[model samples]
Target: MPPVLVKGALHFMLVYARDGHVEILKYDLRCSCLSLVDVPLVGPGIHGAAILMAMEDRSLGFAHVDGLTLHIWSREMDFNRVASWSHRTIIDLRNLLPIQNTDERLRLIGSVEGSDTVFVTTDLGIYEINVKSQRWKEIWKSEKFRALIPYMSFYNPQ
Candidate 1:
């Protein structure tokens, strides 16, 4: 179970499982815990809290909601939230692979090893997002990548 500590007093916990299982379990947070008007929610992930989207000045902040889109706070103090609002860009969440590449996506993960970026994989290829620019680009595009170097360690035989 992962938890998000908000405003100090409130605790938001996210529970997850496979598609068939209920993710949230006995959470300290309930729909009533909020201010009624959806302020901004920062979701919890496997290890830490993840913003379906986030904005930062120097430190990191996260916000995310399942079923709804991910919202990030942006740096432009005038922009207000962690994610930008003036631009209002909507990213299609469908067809995106999970953030966890520890499983079969290990090979896909290796490509972005050195850089401080996040990769979103699809049948199309691997797209790396620049943390600063929030821009996404394709770094690799073959199924063959799934068979390369780190992807081929015989010890962890798939």
Candidate 2:
């Protein structure tokens, strides 16, 4: 998964198939150190995960597939400047897509640079999801691109 920088904090998602656990590694740029983020009980069936920033707030999103339903959960970082996370049910993509097939694989590829929109790739196609509006738009089909990894660039005017 691609890493995201939010408020000078570098975030990386680590997914393990052994227990189907998804954890985040946060590296504080100011302190120049790394710390593991305490994630809530995500349970099993985690397909993919990614970190996104919306309105200056960092959020962790995970995709869980159960049968024919695709569940997405977003966890926002606590505003109290503490090392805590709160989970929120963002959306269920099962009905959003045109095709309704259990064989479709969904993964959180990466987020758009300088935007809250995140890209999710499925076996059928690639979709762009807006974190704030909770809207989805299919950018391209799976045949258009073999990979969905997004490239982000940082520019400092100062």
Candidate 3:
């Protein structure tokens, strides 16, 4: 189960089987309610996925990065009501990332708070990808590094 927090709620990605349909469960902590968010058919090559929120507009973002390409989907979400989100493909990272074949390993780590950028780690380095701008920047690189594990947090100054 892959989980992400969007608009102060928990969204979980539940995959029933390999190469099967995917469903999202939205859990509201305030009311302790869980609702299923229907999703369209997902491709079979999806290996890495992440949920993101655009900081400027607070729109929801979903990314599924396969071995040779990155597929991004986004939609507007209303937290106050039980609304069904409709997503559309926004960008493809094949032009940006150096992917030669389907053997390359890629993983969508997570998104940065207060920004529309999400982090993806490969064998080469860690990259920051902006969903709205369709841009990417390499933040870290190491020849000996085989994988990257990321940690995220929100800081509140009240």
Candidate 4:
């Protein structure tokens, strides 16, 4: 959050609400600097328990961000990460679209091989989240799995 602002340029703010609502606020001290992108309640949310993904996102399975334990998967490589040792504790922070299938399998899945991207797939579709790359860019995704492209992340003015 530390002055991503250019001396006389514009600054952008992306706000996410509890209801999956988002507001993009822009300020340039120049033009209209205001625009709205109404992201209609896109994901699936089960009453009281947690939110799920809509069929639109092609999410196969979703692990509502209410607990720890993560699952990552890579289909092309046919390798899945049931448990990762490098992630440490941040992996426990919270989750959105899940990237593994061990939970759905209920028998605990193992890891895939040679796959760079890892994710999960539900009847709705597939949801994948990158563990290291925080950058937002579209990758060649499969109908088997829809990529959860992140447009914004928290920054500490660094």
Candidate 5:
């Protein structure tokens, strides 16, 4: 669950979760390849949720959470390069959180390295989602679910 850096020429990308069905692996530091990336299948019961992001034109991006509905995928390249998986955005976290239902369960808890900003966990807390500006807040307040490790930095004291 650790290997997702892909910017240009693919230096890292590895996410393999079965039962929820997902498999993506790409690492090619100038021909030292390690392929297998054609991910686009998650419908039948959507098991382990999903996460793998690095988009902003750098291609390769997929984030899936089916319940409160958040499914965004993008990995496109044609003209012979051949690489597909395009179904871009569909977020409906009850129209962006403040959800007051019950039965708790909504976990994505990853992303925000180079930024697409995603970290969601709701027993009623921990939410900082931007996934292309659908904006969000409430950055911490747990009760049950836990697994969040996303760090961002920018400081200048002059």
Candidate 6:
């Protein structure tokens, strides 16, 4: 629901149709310029199933979950400054999580700053997953569905 900041710009996903076709827009902080970024066509019609994140190298990254599969993409730029998304990683949620029902929905709540960990919410509980290691553990459980937002800030208790 919130834009990710990378390379001095804020990148956000925009759904311009009923079927959930997404477009990424980059807003430059220095020049205040807004431009469209070219990303590969992800699965359509799965509303609220995608999230934009800042990669370790400070580039734009995207994650989308379809059924039991999770897709991750990273943005790349050519010599001429042309931008595109490169499909990077795919993880099977069934093997990663302790899932009982195949029909239970999985939503990517958010990602931890400065790490590859992502928070996923399901009927069972909320789990933190390390995308690189494929390791996960349940962090919280709730009777009703809950959404999580990752936030980071410096504390100065002076």
The models' CA-based lDDT, in order, is: 0.34, 0.60, 0.61, 0.29, 0.71, 0.79
Stretches > 4 Å off in candidate 2 = 16-20, 47-83, 143-147, 151-158
Q: Which tens-of-lDDT digit does each residue in 9-65 have in candidate 3? A: 777776667565677778988888998876544564442454444344555556666
lDDT of 5 by residue, 1-158 (tens): 45666654552334334434556778877777787775676454544467777766777787878778888788888899877888988989987888666455687867776667777787777788887888899877873544566666779999
Off by over 4 Å in 1: 1-56, 63-70, 74-116, 142-158
| Model 3, C-alpha of 53: deviation from truth (Å) | 4.8
Best by lDDT: 6
By TM-score, the best candidate is 6
Using all chains and alpha carbons, the TM-scores for the candidates as numbered come to 0.29, 0.67, 0.66, 0.21, 0.31, 0.87
Model 2 TM-score (2 dp):
0.67
Stretches of candidate 3 off by over 4 Å are: 17-20, 47-56, 66-68, 77-89, 98-105, 142-158
User: How many times do residue backbones clash in model 2?
Assistant: 0
RMSD of each: 12.6, 3.9, 4.2, 17.2, 13.3, 2.3
Kindly report which residue stretches of model 5 are placed more than 4 angstroms away from their true locations once superposed: 4-26, 33-50, 53-60, 64-71, 82-87, 95-98, 101-107, 110-120, 124-158
List pairs with backbone clashes in candidate 6. none
Ranking of predictions according to lDDT: 6, 5, 3, 2, 1, 4
Minimal lDDT window, size 10, model 1 = 19-28
Alpha-carbon error at 104 in model 6, in Å? 1.7
What lDDT score is found at residue 52 in candidate 4? 20
lDDT of 1 by residue, 2-107 (tens): 2323322232233344432122222225453442112233223322223222223331233322332233332233444543223223344343333332233222
Clash numbers, per candidate: 17, 0, 0, 18, 0, 0
Candidate 4 structure lDDT: 0.29
In model 2, what lDDT does residue 28 have? 93
Better of 1 and 3 by lDDT: 3
